[model samples]
Target: MIGSEKLVARGLGRSYGDAAVVRHGRTVLTERLDRFLQFDARTGVLECEAGVTINALIDHFLPLGFFPSVVPGTKHVTLGGAIAADVHGKNHHVAGAFSRHVRSFRLLTASGAELECSRANNADLFWATIGGMGLTGIITDVRLTLSPVPSPYVSVRYERASNIDDALELFHADDHRYAFSVAWIDCLSRGGSLGRAVLMRGDFAPNELLTARQRHDGSRRSPTPRLSVPGSAPQFVLATPLMRAFNAGYYHSHPGAPRTKVLSYEPFFFPLDKIRNWNRLYGRRGFLQYQCVLPSVGGREGLIRILEMISSSGSASFLAVLKRFGEGEPGQLLSFPRVGYTLALDLPNRGPEVFELLERLDALVVRFGGRVYLAKDARMRPETFRAMYPEFRTWLAIKNEVDPDWRFSSDLAVRLRLMD
Candidate 1:
């Protein structure tokens, strides 16, 4: 069902936008090539086909004590997709991006020649491919470092923050106590409550930390999703009033008394994963997931302005997440994480109004030295993209040098003018 002049490799199509779609062109579905090539239990290293999904990893290897060191909100993503997007999770402030754990990968270039890429061999290609979003080349296989966990349980702490300031303070003052941390914010709240959020932090719970029943239970393997949305939800179900109510319910549900509890890993990391086809809840128009990072210098102020703008505009996102990102390889050229705050918002496709609000948000992002995550972007202007990611020039030079004719291109690349 896919064929064209310029091609882009697609894995699972969970990128939320045109990154994986080729429009009228050919989109080579890489999922069929999924396979596990090698595994080393002692070293906690895994080498597998690029098409392998995070869900596949946990299902097959989590029981064996190995897990991907980095993951996104959902596990329905492929290893190649994770590396391409340079996905980050609650552990970003600690583990950095997904590329940090990737040992090496095999790249199939536009010239039909295969190259072994890593920090050592074809190093430039390796960095470019890390977060290149399939614009660099087609990654066929990857070798990644995995973390060894005692069990599939996590020790979690919940904190209630009055606003963005309190959340940031808690993150800075308490994040060192855990391995993973994130916040679910209410974008519909204005005034002093502009950033009211629930700060959730966690670390893999040790065997000794788990209760005997929870520990000795033989069904300790990954649990399958028990619920699904079934079909698209009516657009009216997510209007501002309903979303505000939902956000209110979520905020109140967690009194967040700085409590710590042991829970299974599935819900701790991938809560939305329990519900299949959950995206359909946004309705037939779908939703735009806007994710951007603000540098440490003006991050807080920039973030506040953003939240305030969204709240005042009456364009509330159903899911708003905030997190801190630590340092990353500055020389990598294309990765998204910086040492600062990052926010992700999911807004319903309410037509022109949504785009207008996003444009206003873009101005703030550009002024604050922020860049949108290409993996989640659906409607970003070329100028805005360039302003946000000046490193694109560096990555572009590498892409031109490798794929001069521009054989590797996607709808996203065309929209952002990455090839022009």
Candidate 2:
């Protein structure tokens, strides 16, 4: 199908943008391709179809004391999407992106030829496809290395920071001791409270740390109570004042002193999963998730400027997160992570105003040597995209080599003129 027509392979449609949509072109859904092809229990290497989801991986393997080396905020994303985006997680400072653990994959090129790609075999194609956004080819199967853990629970420590500097200090002072680290920032806070956050850091819980019941529960898929937004919300649901209050309430709720607790992996990693259709909170127009990483050299100052802009703009973000990224994988040219601080903001889509605000944010990010996550972008200009990803030329060269006719394309690809 790919050889004869313009199309794009889609996994779970979890990407926030149109990376999976092809406009008038065909979309090949990989859901039916879901299957576990092979497994090496001793070494923890598992080969599975592209459609296999993080949720399935956890439900099946967590009981056996294994987990994907990296998982994004949600588990609904498929393995193919994870690789296409080179998704990172809370432990990025330690684990790097998902592509780092990928051993190899089978790619069906535009010519209908199946190529086995890895660091040592067809190496160029391997790195290209890692974060290539499915433009190079359709990924059929993947061999990945899973990390071993003592239990399914995570032992988490929470600390409150009065401002952005305090948060950075807390993270820099202790990031090496924890496997996972993230902070919930109050984007609406101003003055002395600007960038205030609650930092959560943790590692997999050891068996000795678990209670008798927890040991017996051991990776059992317990049913978590869920709530769903019944319908499209009113535009005022996320009004600036309401969001400001929510941010304040959340900030003051966390204890100022450090606190520790053992939590199931589900809540620790995917808190939003508990609220189904949470996006509905943003109303019928939806919301835009702008995520960017500033190089550590100027990251702190960049964050302050960015936060000040957001606060003054009055387009409050109901959900904001701050995290530190370690060095990036040299092989994945288009991958987003680097040694820096990344901030993600969930802003209500208020038409032109929101776009204008994002443009300003983009300029600041570029000035600070930062780049936005392609997986979450929907409205970035072509020139801005070029400015953020300097390796696009190299990635384009490989795309042209494997898919000269541009057989695989998406709304995102065309919007950014990726082929040009």
Best by lDDT: 2
The residue pairs found clashing in candidate 1 are 3-26, 4-26
Query: How well does candidate 1 match the true structure in TM-score terms?
Result: 0.97
Q: Mind giving the per-residue lDDT tens digits that candidate 2 earns over 148-185? A: 98899999999999999999999999899999999999
Q: List the candidate 2 regions with Cα displacement exceeding 4 Å.
A: 1-3, 222-225
Native-to-model Cα distance after best TM-score fit, residue 35 in candidate 1, in Å:
2.0
lDDT of 1 by residue, 1-420 (tens): 122268789999989889987766677789867899999999989999999999999888888887899989999999999989999998988898999999999999888888999999999899999889998778999999999987888888888898899999999997877899999999998888789999989899888888989877624666677899989998788888888888888898887577888998888889899998888888898888889899999899999999989998767766889999989975577788888999999988899999999999999999999988889988999999999988888898899999898888899998988877
> Which stretch of 10 consecutive residues in model 2 shows the poorest summed lDDT?
217-226
lDDT of each: 0.88, 0.90
Stretches off by above 4 angstroms in model 1 are 1-4
Worst ten in a row by lDDT for model 1: 1-10
